[model samples]
Target: MGGLLGVLLVWRVASALFGGGEPGLPSGGGTPASPTPTDDGGNGVPASTVEVAEDFPLPAIGTRLEFKILGLGDDPKRCEAVGLLVGDDQRTAYHHLCGDAEAGTDVYFFLVRIVNHSDAAQPIALASFEMTADGGDTLPALDVETANATREHYFPERIELGPDSRIKKFVAFDGSPPFTPARLTYVDGTQALVIHLRGTWIGA
Candidate 1:
């Protein structure tokens, strides 16, 4: 009985850490491919390498996207109000379930802006947004309820932008340890845009 109880406890802890006990997280799956330049498949979106200062272009849809990390101590009031405020029960539950409690991982937020520079309206499928850790784990953004709370713009599921129009929002991803590199990618069937992330500093 003692041995069986110990085994169950270990399983429970593992389930909490990586087995998708948290809402909006996918269940365990194979590790994702590490972010790297891929050959252009004739879709007009080239595989480009860029620093944080560069804007990744996706001309196939006549739009450009920019991503910026909300660095340490740069917390926004909306982010604080959205249940991610330090010591909030929701955030604590996330850290205990979806995060690496021992390694102090939680969630990190980023600001993303998409601009349509073409002569006509351009449509975007926001569901294609995803982030991959250097460790090869695919981190899904929190569900719309939690993620959209961080900004008035509110991340949308799909949208069409008029010429010279732009939309920006805050997206929250499962956090990693300090300096754990990651990449956020927006890949639809025809075009792909990549944003190289320098890693996050916030911990549980």
Candidate 2:
């Protein structure tokens, strides 16, 4: 009987530790996990835990942009440019918040939030993204070579966004002193999406 009791206690402990308890039951009555952190931390400043560029502009949250899916014969899907962050510190604590470290002074970080509003999934090719400045300079999306050199985080070659789903990804650009991008363009061979960045700039 003692042996059986000991086994039962062991089972209970294992279940608690391994999430084997009854469904919907709160373990230890603690709070649930929090959602991922966005750029806005409720205050007017950037939500980074590390030092950011002194003059970096913060894009207003909820700015919406639309895109058409080529070959799908569907209506345009909406993508919101949710966040914009730039800093020189490679060891910034915000690294985990967005997924990658900074590249340094020569490389700056740009984050854009893309949300799908269509009924079907939308595939985005990160490699096709381009940043254009008002000075007639066009910067291509970061490639493997650039990413390795900067040690900056980058998006996957392709990402599928389910209907009504959202994803925030980092896009690195080559610029010694960070400047506002005039426009962000994405070409997927069949269709193209152009987002004007004229009024989206907010100084730090």
Candidate 3:
């Protein structure tokens, strides 16, 4: 029974990562449409989906993070970093970049939204995710209590999502210097997901 349970567990994680739906690529021969810009100046900053080339294949078991620019309160002298995931596709991770220069802090708040596209329920743990910087620094995610104390937005520990259902939570990281982050990574034993941010500016 123990061995059976272990096999079952691995199967679930695999399903969550690969997903059961068709690939997110265009089906016809024509190129995919360009992502529409959603920047209305409501937040005093432009917002738009980063355009991936039509031929860029979506990662089989990974997520994408997109950053946004937010005005810092009434202080026109200060800037606030904000972002969100590109789409609501299941099995894809989403994230936001946040930091306070005055406080000498910068961090990545990853909102991992897992949807069980498989037939059974899948259990996920925070231990399955990892964040690393360009300088070979392996950053540790803050515990729920510590993250909550530091930022108003944070996610709790483990989670489980049923088939056709989804759950979203935040994972906080203090990996690199403010606006100097290089890469983000996630692993689920069988597969690995890496998001590259080299040569990218935070509030640009």
TM-score of each: 0.47, 0.42, 0.47
- Per-residue lDDT of candidate 2, residues 1-204 (tens digit): 232222222221111222211122123321222222325423222344221111112211121223311111011121112222223211110111111223333333344555565677877676667766667477776553322232223467777778788665555555434455665555433333444443322221
Against the true structure, candidate 3 reaches a TM-score of 0.47
Better of 1 and 2 by lDDT: 1
RMSD per prediction, one decimal? 14.1, 20.4, 16.2
Model 1 lDDT tens row, 1-204 = 232222222222122222222232123311222334565433223456321222111111212432222222222322221122322212211121221233344454444566665677767665666776667666555444432132343466677778787775645554444324356666644345555543222433
lDDT of 3 by residue, 93-156 (tens): 2222222322334444444444455666666656655555555556655555532142323444
Steric overlap count per candidate = 1, 0, 1
Q: Over 4 Å off in model 1, which ranges?
A: 1-105, 146-151, 176-181, 199-204
Name the better of 1 and 2 by TM-score. 1
- Model 1 accuracy (lDDT, Cα): 0.40
User: In what order do the candidates fall by TM-score, top score first?
Assistant: 1, 3, 2
lDDT of each: 0.40, 0.37, 0.37
Model 3 / residue 187 / CA error / Å: 1.9
> After best superposition, candidate 1 residue 199: deviation in angstroms?
7.5
Q: What is the lDDT of residue 85 in candidate 3?
A: 28
Model 2 error, position 75 (Å): 39
